[model samples]
Structures are given as structure tokens and as C-alpha cells.
Target: MWGSDTDVLNLALAATVAATVAAAGWLAVALARARRAHRRSVDERGWLLERERESAARTAVDEERARIARELHDIVSHKVSLMVVQANAAREVLDAMPQEAEKAMAAVESAGRDTMTELRHLLGLLAPAQDGSEPAPEEAAQLTPQPSLSRLSSLIDRFAFAGLPVEVRISGEPRPLPTGIDTTAYRIVQEALNNALKYGGGRPTEVTVRYADHSLRVEVLNSGPSVLRGDAPAPPQPDGERPDGAGRGLLGLRERVAVYGGDLDARRRLGGGYRVRARIPLERA
Candidate 1:
């Protein structure tokens, strides 16, 4: 009977040892699973960070593209306006002196044709790509032109037609204004008129162009009920030169005029309106 009891205890001890081993094996498997899960979580975090970086890069590329387009517009439009103005001046000369007018007309035709060609080239650069390929720098080099003093009137007329009432008042004999000066003047007036129309809330606006001995002046004024009193949302700014909704437009104009070493002033009229004034030196035709 004592031997039997001893045998039974031995069997029980063996069973207990086996059970303990099985539980330890299960604990090892659980630890392995937790480690795998931790690794997967780390990988997922890395993937998310990579995606965020790519998104930011894409946004930066888009912003850079817009900035380049604006610069090209300023350079091209300013030059083209000058050419058109000169062509008109030539036509005036041709009318006054028939023999000289014939020669002047020929020159004007040649200039107009050349300007049109250049404009087409620049337009191609301004337009977004149809294909995924990026534009080459050579395209920009080929498209740029050196425009001078002759294209102011046509530029002003374009604004007038666009909705701003623009008028030119020449005080001195209309000699050639410098290229930079002419471009600055045209852009300043153009931007100001654009601002007036956009932020003026359908109010009447006036643009006055003045040619003086040493300087060219452009002024744009729009009158309406005070913007401050209205329930209208703040005007959108293209740039932040003014508090009005026309900020961007005014800012762009300000930068443009500054390039030619020009001065611009913008303010709200006391009675209730907006005023923009730009002055450029006539030194480099």
C-alpha cells in the first residue's frame, strides 16, 4: 500500500511539471506577437511621415510656379504696352507729315509684327503645360523682349476698356519715356485700375496719366460708399499693400513699380473712396 501511494504522488508531480512547461510556451508566443505588432506600428508611422513630406513638396512646387508666372507677366506685359504706344505715336507722325508718315508707318508695322511674335512666345510660357514635362529655361530666354517707351496709350486704353475710365493728360512735348519708366507707369496704372474695379464694388473709377519733364505719373481713384461701413467681407489681397479687399492687386502693383525704382502711394479718400498714385522717372528709353 505504501509503494502504491508513492507511485501515485510521483505521477501527480510529473503532470504538474508538464502543465507548467505548457504555460511558459504560451507566454513566449504572446511576447513574440507583441514584438511583431510594435514593429508594424513603427513602419506605419514612417510611412505617414513620408506621405506628409511629399505633400509639402507638391505644395511648394505649385507656389513656385505661380510666382514665376507673375514675374513673366510683369516683364512681358509692360514691354508690349510700350511697343503699342510707340506704334500709335508713329501713326500720328505719319499723319502730320505724309512723306515722313509713310516711313514711320513702315517702321510701326515692322515693330508691331515683331511685338506680336514675341507676345505669342511669352503666352506659350505663361500657359500651363498640357503634358507632364516641365518647361525649359530656353523657352523663357527666347520669349523675353526689351520693350521701350512707345506703348503707353494702348496700355491705358486696354484698362479703360476693361472698365476703368482712363484718360491721358500730357503737359510737355511727348518725348520718349524710358523703357523701365514706361513699364512702371503702365503697370502701376493697370494694377490700380484693376484694384478699383475688384474692390470698388461696381463704383466708378478714374485713371489719369500725366507725362511731365522728368517723370511720368499715374493716378487711379474710385469713389463709393465707405468700404468700412459696408457689410462686405474684407477684400482679397493679391499682395498686402492695403487693408482693402484689393490687397493682392495693390501688392502686385507695388512690387512692379518698385522694380523700376518707382514710388506708389495708396490710401482711402477722406470723403469715402480709394486712391492710388504712382510716379516713375523718365531716364532710360
Candidate 2:
């Protein structure tokens, strides 16, 4: 009876050991699968992060390109317009009015020089230093200051010299504005005046700037038959079409104003001319 009991006890012990071994094997397999899944998840996250960085870099580059294009458009369009007008005047009076022709030629030269100066300033700001460092003090000093409302009088004078008479009116106390707002405001007036010069049919233009407690408003109005100087009468275009191809100037202005959370309206007036108005909020700016 004692021998039979010992055999049964040994058999029970063997079964327990076998069950424990099977359980350990299953746990080992599950651990290996879990490790592999974690590794795969980590690799996928790394790839996604890399893709996001690349997308962000591309977006930054596109935005910078757009800004440079806008700057070039504003500088070149306004200055070149003045140069063209002066050149035309010079040519028309070269024989009969030699003195007046000389004066016009001088104006052309001045406008050309001003254009080069501004272009140089813009390009200087864009240029990278040789060692990818900040610009040297001397080099920075050579760059001309950007146009602002303070320079509006000179801007108007240039237009008047080009045969576009401009009258200016200011309401409310003029105060200092943020750099971005000031530059944008000046550009709005500039582009509007340029449009007037090109299409105002030599009619007198008016520029009004109103400063309010919370917002600034600028308006440009010109009575027009919409004819280009020294050329045949321009054909009637579809509404919203400008003579300079697709009205890129106005579109750029809109984009600029939108950046500052401002509203821009450019439309043909009820009676006969074109009007451009922009309202920029100072509080938000």
C-alpha cells in the first residue's frame, strides 16, 4: 500500500511541472511579439515627424517667396510708371520746348535713380552674409529706410510731376503707427496713386487719410475716362480688369491688407472714376 501511494504522488508532481513549463513558453512568445509591435510603432512615429518637418519648411519657403514678389511688384510698378510718364513727356517736347524736355528728362533720371536705390535697399535686406551672419553695421547703414506716411508728400509730388495732379487731405491727429502698418498704409496709397496715374485720363486725383481711435482709413479717388498716356484710347475691359494685365497691383494690395486683418475695396465709382479705399484696424495691429 505504501509503494502504490508513492507512485501516485510522483505522477502528480510530474504533471504540475509540465503545466508550468507550457505556461512559461507561452509567456515568452507573447513578450517577443509585444517587443516587435513597440519597435514598429516607434519607427512609424519617427517617419511621420520627419514628414511634418519637411512640410513646414516648404510652407515657410513659399511664404517668403510671396513676400519678395510683393515687394518687387510695388517698387518696380510705381517707379517705372513714373519713369515711363517722364520719358514720354521728354520725347513729346524734345523739339519745340527744349527747356521743358530737358526738365522732363532730368525727372526721368531722378526717378530711375530712386528706383535703383530702393531696389538696392530691398536686395540688400534679402542678401545673406558671406558667413551666414548678421549684416555688418556699415552694410546695414547703407540700406535706405522704407517709405512711410512721413514720406507721403514726396510721393505725391512725384506723381504730380508725372502729370497726375494729386490733392491730399488729412483728418484727425496723425500719430506714429507700427512699422508694418505704416509701410502697408504707404504702399496702399502708392499703388492706388499708380493706378490713378495709369488710368485716370489726366484727371485730378484726391488722397484722403483719416485716423480714428481704433482704425485708420485711406482713400484714393480719380475721375477718369481710363486712357493710357501717349497711346490710343484703351478698350473697355470687363469689370475688375486693370490695364496692367490682370490687376496684380490691386490683388497684391488686397493680400497685404488681409495680412493685417484689414479690408480693401477698389471699384469703379458711380459717376465716372475709380476709387480705392482701405481700412486697417490699429488695435489688432
| Best of the candidates, lDDT | 2
Of candidate 2, the 10-residue stretch with the lowest lDDT total is: 225-234
TM-score of each: 0.45, 0.79
- For model 2, the stretches where C-alpha displacement exceeds 4 angstroms are 1-42, 226-233, 236-246
lDDT of 2 by residue, 136-212 (tens): 79877877688899999999999988999899999988999989889989998999888888877778889999999
Which tens-of-lDDT digit does each residue in 55-172 have in candidate 1? 9999988866754565455544433444454455566766577776565455546546655666666566567678857668876566545443356566555445434465555455
What RMSD does each model have against the real structure?
12.9, 4.8
lDDT of each: 0.63, 0.85
Task: Kindly provide the TM-score of model 2 when superposed on the true structure, using C-alpha atoms.
Answer: 0.79
